[model samples]
Target: MPAEKINNSNQAVAHSFAFVACVTCAVSTAHAQSSVNLYGEIDAGLAYFSNIGGHASYQATSGLVDGSFWGLQGTEDLGNGNKAIFRLESGFSTTTGESLDDHPHYVGLANDSFGTLTLGHQYDLIHDYFAPFTLTGGAGGTAFAHPFDNDNANNTYLASNSVKYVSPTLSGFSAAALYAFSNDAGQFANNRLYNFAANYQNGPFTAGAAYLHANGRGNTAGGAFEPVLLPGANRDVFNASVAKQNTYATGASYVIGDLTLAAAWSRSTFSGVTDADSGAVEPSAGFSNYEVSGVYQLMPSLVLAAMYTYTKGSSAHWHQGGVQADYVFSKRADVYLEAVYQSASSGAPAIINSADPSSSRNQLLIGTGLRAHF
Candidate 1:
């Protein structure tokens, strides 16, 4: 009877171990089947500027290097090599509760092994591939952008109703293309944009080229209109018109040890017009601009950066330069100080008065800020 009792005890212990192993396997499988992630960054700072045209004021701003945004992304395995994926991103002003550009909800999707395509409002290819090489990336938002941001450094050309496609990388090379529909119903050609870019990176060097085209209408006739007496019958003229613009840029960057160098060149043009009164034809006006910049690492967590930019308009030219230093307290947090100055050429329109070519304006800006990410 004692031998029988010993055998029964051994059997019970084996059964208990088997049940625990089964439960562990079930929990592991459940974890593998589900996943969700949350991530974002917040940037804010105080800024002071001298010679802001006719006004002198100090203010706080958000999203200098990278915009403040939060997003949720997830994926689920369906079967075989297929999976389902989605992302929802929202941009907002960190200093205020307002949404970024007043658009709060942005979302999109991806297919396994094919590519990613997103909808709603988004950045152009130039902003995605080239903006990172500028001083704004390292100098804590102190880099000088081209006059009127004609070089696209300030990201003034976000596309609405945009669709973007990014190809899978092959041997350190990848390509992307994007198109934005105007969605103006019958006015399909109005406010439309398209972009394409290709890039290659191997080791410590990277290079890219991109092109952008945009067409839109502007209101230039809303101000008080005065007509001078003419020999012909008095006819009221308005200055509303359709504008076409094109941008092309190429950039390269190389990193050796702790130092990195970068440079870029770009050109832009604008033309086309429509009379506001009778929708008649009108003359077109256009301009071109260029920029270059560099940066260096003083320590593992400290960096110094500078930039120079020149913009040549139809009636004026502009020169701008800036520098800044940044210190990283951690992988996700940093603080920085930046300063930028601008000087215009005689042939360019005055920075203060667009109508006076002889007038010149100088601007100085200083700021300090902090940024964090998760």
Candidate 2:
């Protein structure tokens, strides 16, 4: 009778194990149906400007090249090789929690295998790549940006009500297109912008081309800064008009061992009534900009970079140079020091000094900061 009882107990234990395995498999299958992720970065720094138009100041800032923000991204797997995806991102000041560009929230969606489409506040293609490769070092923050950031053309990165599409990679090549709406129903064309870009990467060589067009009103000016006052203009001729503008740029980069090299060129043209009335008497006035930069890794945790940029405006011209060094404390944190100097020619009014009535001037900046990611 005792041996019979032992055999019955063993059979019951085996049956219990089989039941647990079945339940585990079911839970795993359910989890595979959905996925969600959380991600973000926090970057802040202390900076000082020696001569901000004859004034010196100090402050703390965020998002030097990449803004600081937290976001959620997720996807739901529908059977038959299809999936639905979504993302919500927010940008805020690390020092004061103030939103950047008056926007605190952004959202978008896409398909799994097909190309992705997203609508919200986002960066144009030039800001996506060229800005970083140029004097701004791609960081729109106060530290690495170009002198007066005139070359940035007021984009500082990101636009409201932007819709973007990204194509899948084909042999290390991809393309993207974007459109931004002014969000005003009656003034459909006001502040509207469109951009397209193509890129290719193979081995240690990479190249890209991009185009941008903008039309409408408000502060969506085509240049880094508006032009200076003209001889015969009633209003502050410095203000850009609700006009049409077109821009194009191309760039390439190469990497060899510890050194990387890059170069880019861009042109912008402005037209319409405002431009004409403000002394752009001809069909339009434009500017051409060129940049070259390089980075060298001195150590596993240290990098040094330098860049030179030239802007030849149809109405003005300027030259700028910058140098920087960064030390990596870890993969997620780093400290950097940088300096930039800019000089204008007397041919026309200095573009960087539009606020002042000056034909030739020089400006300098120095800063140090820290950046972290999670």
Candidate 3:
């Protein structure tokens, strides 16, 4: 072949190779597109309690209203409107820098039309669906909780070894389901849990409900609901192992101009209760809670809220009332002040959600806190 012809052939081969490399790089960039984000929120404050184990107390507090937590969340675009997502969240005490519980630690897939599914440690249906209508970590946090948070209206627990599914919102409606494994051989039902929930929101109106069932809750370490429910000594819930627990809750809210009104109800039943250490079977117990709350947007960046709850139990009962004021300095920071009063039935100790039991049947708490998001 002539020299010119040979050079032309070599240049043709090089152009072909370059074209293939460019196409490969373009495809790789499209398919491998992904993103990850680190996110967190912190709440710290000081509180005064009128009665805690018989004495007035003042102390530093963390998560006085909203729990302090940090987490990472990410998503990878997978073609055809599908994506891969994951989140890992952990709670901690701001006062002492101690680690608390964890949640939403799972990986899953999401689609624009379908929805989301995740596996691992996560919240139950009640917290996802119904708790929003109450003051659960919203306008009023710890101050608005029911007696001992018996109904989990304040999100006191998380399930491990779990699988969760959430449906996409359609016409202002959504649904969810979750199941947690016991993870113990030969004991499939021990400490296992299943939950279902549905919610709807349309403009100024919103409604939701949820149901949760657990067998032998707090009975096994390798199961859901391992840690005891509350932090108080009053109803023995902190010291009791529930053989079976069932909770049902529903709520709704309506927004009118700058004021919002809300109402909610929940029932919790405990059967075959046993002492955690002594293993002594105790009588069955039940709790019914009814709550009404309202929030007023005093200004664009400031809000005032109030709530009242009445809890009736098989053995004891409580009445709780609270008020809160919050001012947002910016999109990432806020300050709040709250006051709460709780009174228990005769002969029953008053137990605030995040505070120790009062020696008598009445308790009061006043607090102020600041929260920042990043």
Q: RMSD per prediction, one decimal? A: 9.1, 7.2, 3.7
Which candidate achieves the best lDDT against the true structure? 3
Show where candidate 1 strays beyond 4 Å: 1-34, 79-83, 102-113, 137-143, 217-241, 273-287, 347-360
**Can you write out model 1's per-residue Cα lDDT over 159-195, one digit (the tens) per residue?**
6677888777888888889887766666666667788
State the lDDT of candidate 2 residue by residue for 1-374, as single tens digits. Answer: 69999999999999999999999998788678878788888877765554443565565756544567887878777676556667777778888888755222344555545677777766677766565455454432343443334334334445567788888778888899988886665776776778898888899998888888877534334322133222111233245454666778878889899988888788866666355244443345676878888888889999888878787777667787778888989988988887766677764433222123232466555667788877
> Candidate 1 lDDT (Cα, whole model)?
0.63
List, in order, the clash count of every candidate structure: 4, 6, 0
Higher-lDDT candidate of 1 and 2 = 2
Which one is best on TM-score? Answer: 3
Q: lDDT per residue, candidate 3, 249-359, as tens digits?
A: 999999999999999999999887888888887788788999999999999999999999999999889999999999999999999999999999998778788888889
Q: How does candidate 2 fare on TM-score?
A: 0.75
Task: Provide TM-scores for the models.
Answer: 0.75, 0.75, 0.90
